[model samples]
Target chain A: MNANIPSEVLPILLILIGTIFSLLSAIGLVRLPDVYTRSHAASKSTTLGVLFILVGTFLFFLLEEHYFSIRLFLGIFFVFLTAPVAAHVLVRSAYRSNVALAEESVQDDLKDFIHTDSKKTKDAEVNDTD
Target chain B: MIEIMLICSLIFLTLSIIAIMYRLVKGPSASDRVQALDTLGINIISGVAVFSVLMRSTGFFEVILLIGILSFIGTIAFARYLERGVVIERKHPK
Candidate 1:
């Protein structure tokens, strides 16, 4: 909110926003009771945080150094591409491995689809237990 | 002023990384460790960004990309291993 030295402060402010989100995700990761909840926090919040930091850095370099970085742009793109997929793959494996849900969580929307024996095909079961 | 803020950002990033490490070390399950590693990677990326800004350099840009690639691949490999019991599944020739 300090606006005195107005022009360059925006980049730093954005970086602060990113670091704060990272702090938020770290807290969530530590405090969440279950793996699913922890994955949620780890994936989403930190992705946004990293995005903000990269964008802010790109802006800073552009404004102050007169440099355009293709690499930074690619970093942004790669994080966006991979963060959710990694989290998804990780959580799916967690579920497949029989990790239990937290006691506090009441509703399991995927229960019928994921755990029902009759609903699963023969090959699906093979792949699942393989 | 810019230096002070970037330094502060780095401090916060370091603190976050430490907290994530707690989970990494104490996490009860394999997936928990994977998640922690992913989060740690993201934090390291930002940390590197802030450090580069502090140093007023563009050299670490590739470091950021490298970390991202490595982290993503590591997470996927860990997940596959956890789920399937092997990172690479070999086909049985019929």
Candidate 2:
């Protein structure tokens, strides 16, 4: 196989950008003050990083016209589907468990859910016995 | 030249791993540590992908698959535990 720098250049650039983004995400994970914010860093940046890096890999192998380039594509596909779903599940679970957030967390919408649900359950019991 | 770039990226990834380790060790809460570990798994998956490219082999893809499934399971388990503080089924109240 003949070496082609131009064909590989874009992939290299992509990988470099991905590496930087991933590093930034890791830093954010450390610096973010609460679990909710840290989940933002862990989920969003890392997802983007993996996407860019996988694109890099896909381009690198596809340029070479290798048969196994299919695997990279598959990896990219799986990451895209799973990353955000996992993040959502984790965050919802955290909220359900009443994980404390920083005082600066300007909103408390879930408090309403907790209250409304409890009231619904109590009303159900009253109706059942009446 | 490609090998050198790959090595440099690998080093950056390692540094990210170190930062993640610091977070894991110093995270103020269990939730924080769990999130860090989740990030760690993703990083390791990408690192393996890089190595597979550098070696011109596809064997590492299987490892990526394994890591992906295991990490997903682990995250769910941790989420369940965080939500209820238990990993097993609760006995029915008599």
Candidate 3:
């Protein structure tokens, strides 16, 4: 394929950036102190990492082969939409299951909220019994 | 030059996957393992994309899309199962 300088350079640049982000995310996964923090690293960096790589691939095919792909676009959109929601669900499930926070976690606002809500439900149950 | 860069990047990606696998094996809690698994899925997607580019083929686009869908569904299912003991429920009229 005959290509100009910018056309050739951009995909390489994107791939390098994507690979670095993916590596960093992996390191964060291995080194983070807790599940919550690890989820942060895993979801955010990896999403972006995959995005960059997909974008790079799209551009490579577009320029090198003069062909456009709808699948790549769909993949990009799907990853962007789903990755964060999946992470949120994972963390929320962990919290509801009473996963312990790190020792460095100083405050828990959800604890009081949950306690009061449970008490109010119990009171409602007693009044119904009466 | 480009081929060499792609090769080196592939090596780096493999190492990163190995590092994530370490967490997958060593995670103390179920959520930790799940989180690592989610990250592993994303890593695999990136790896597949890079591999397709390196090989100058577009046949793997469908594979990338399929992995993304399956991983998201798996993460949601695991999260629901963890939040409650059941992933699906039947409702009865009162």
Candidate 4:
């Protein structure tokens, strides 16, 4: 109710910073050259952004409304668990499917490993359909 | 004054979503579109959080979790489909 309280100010500050983070992630997504780099921006920055934003809301409700929302806390936990995993899964698929990396990218350590890996799996898939 | 700040944040979040949408539509590869969808889900979650805070209510909490779960599952499924052209993994073909 009272914005003058120092604790109250913290939540709003967090919300604003998170908004900036999300905005930056959006910019990164639009500007990045490859899906991998874009995933980096999307997963890392947006995870931080959403986490901070949710934490701000949780604190706001706890302090101002005298409420403790277990759901909000759980939401925080779920995002922490899932964002990176999803990004990794997507990039893995992209690489295996031969989606080319951005030309300027510096290294290709997974090149040989993925070649052997996908071949075995591709053979198994051929059998599965038969 | 607080309401104004929340509104401004909402505006910024909307802009973020729109920028992402361009990538979703024009992305050269399916993987790019999948990544865009994941980011879009995150933005929606943040937007709902801001709107909930502005409303001064706790009701949007469930929506946040639901979207998170669905986005995660959808991303995983798409990734699997892209990798091996299979999502459910019916058999290993021993």
Candidate 5:
């Protein structure tokens, strides 16, 4: 199946795939109900989208220009490394700062842990006051 | 044929960027805005990549790297500030 298509078509195919995913991510950002869901969209889809686009771009440069671009490789690695961390931080801070979850959310396992932690802190504060 | 595909992808990227910008502007909470901003940064990187292909130049690769680093820092800082009301802390002598 792979033999029939010309070599030049692959990069273009990758780019189109990346573009569609990226657009879906953006649409998700706008359409999702709250910060948590939107963050999910922003992080996962964009990471994959950018990865595809970067790989495609890398191949295009490699094949057409016969140039090996270290920067393209670096960009791909950087995006993969940083995007998830950024999303995690964003969601953590949002949760800590009392950002309301969507009404439709069914369960919150973190609530118990957070409540216990806060209770322990209050106990420590009372001991300090004595 | 490739040029035409590239052009269409570029248009799609632009539309995606616009959608992200809308969320950035109208997000009901700070975290949503920050999330939008982070996504926007990623979109910009893709846009730059597409443009580099369109122009057949390697010059913009550095710009993509720079944006990636800066946006990461920006997101972290904003997250820290949101979490603790401070982005940096100094230890006080006991």
Candidate 6:
């Protein structure tokens, strides 16, 4: 295998970028408040980081003409599909269970549900009284 | 061969882990601790992947699978306990 400057240079660049992004994501994860926000850090950053690393691996192997480069590509594809789905399931479960948000949290779209819920209970009590 | 960048990123990850660990230890609420644990679990998975690359072996693939499975199970258990306050079922029939 011939060692070309361009082929070797690109993957190394990708690896550095990916690693930096992953580090930033982790830092965000550590600094964020509340479960929801933290999940954003863990999910999004980890996904991008893995993609970057996988790309790095893919390029590394491709330049070398190794057969296992395909395996690395497949891994990247599967992870991209699964990571977001898993994150959604976890976050939705948390929401369904009515986990409390930070006190400073604003823009709660679910507030209407809570309001209408209590109103329905009050209406039920009034009807029962009659 | 960006070994220097890779090592730097590993160090950064370690620092993040320390912060997450602090939350896990000092968390006042059950959910917070669960979040920390989940983050830690992901970090471990990534760390193993990095190690596998560094060692130039695919043997760590099993470790990745094991960690993913256990972390998923553990997260579900913790979430259940958070919602229901129990980790195991009772023998009494409904």
Best by TM-score: 4
Per-residue lDDT of A1-130 in model 1, one digit per residue for the tens? 5744665777888999998999999999999999999987898999999999999999888887789999999998999999999999999999988788899998998887776743465567689668
DockQ of each model against the real complex?
A: 0.92, 0.63, 0.86, 0.90, 0.91, 0.29
* Model 5 CA deviation exceeding 4 Å by range: A1-5, A116-130
Q: Give candidate 3's error at residue B70 in angstroms.
A: 0.2
- Kindly indicate the candidate among 1 and 2 with the higher TM-score: 1
Those runs of model 6 whose alpha carbons end farther than 4 Å from true positions after fitting are A1-6, A69-78, A96-98, A112-130, B84-92
Question: What lDDT score goes with residue A78 in model 1?
Answer: 95
- How would you encode candidate 5's per-residue C-alpha lDDT over A1-130 as one tens digit per residue? 4553466578778989999999999999899999988887899999999988999899888877789999889999999999999999999999888899899999999988876886797798689767
Query: Which model is ahead, 2 or 6, in terms of TM-score?
Result: 2
Tell me the TM-score of candidate 3's A chain. 0.84
For candidate 3, give the lDDT of residue B62.
Answer: 98
What are the fnat scores of the candidates, in the order listed? 0.92, 0.62, 0.86, 0.90, 0.90, 0.14
Where does model 1 sit among the CAPRI classes? high
Per-model lDDT: 0.90, 0.82, 0.90, 0.92, 0.91, 0.66
> Which residue pairs collide, candidate 1?
none
Candidate 2: Cα lDDT at B40: 93
Give me the displacement of residue B8 in model 4, in angstroms: 0.6
Give the CAPRI class of candidate 2: medium
Interface RMSD of 6: 3.0
TM-score (all chains, Cα) for each model: 0.91, 0.86, 0.91, 0.93, 0.92, 0.72
- Could you give me the TM-score of model 3 versus the true structure? 0.91
Candidate with the larger TM-score of 3 and 5: 5
Clash counts per candidate, in order, are 0, 0, 0, 0, 0, 0
| Residues A7-114, model 4: lDDT tens digits | 677788889999999999999999999987888898899999999899999988888778999999999999999999999999989998999889999999999998
The candidate that wins on DockQ is 1
lDDT, candidate 3, B1-94, per-residue tens: 8888888888889999999999999998899888889989999999999999899999999999999999999999999999877898655324
Q: Which pairs of residues collide in candidate 2?
A: none
Candidate order by DockQ, decreasing, is 1, 5, 4, 3, 2, 6
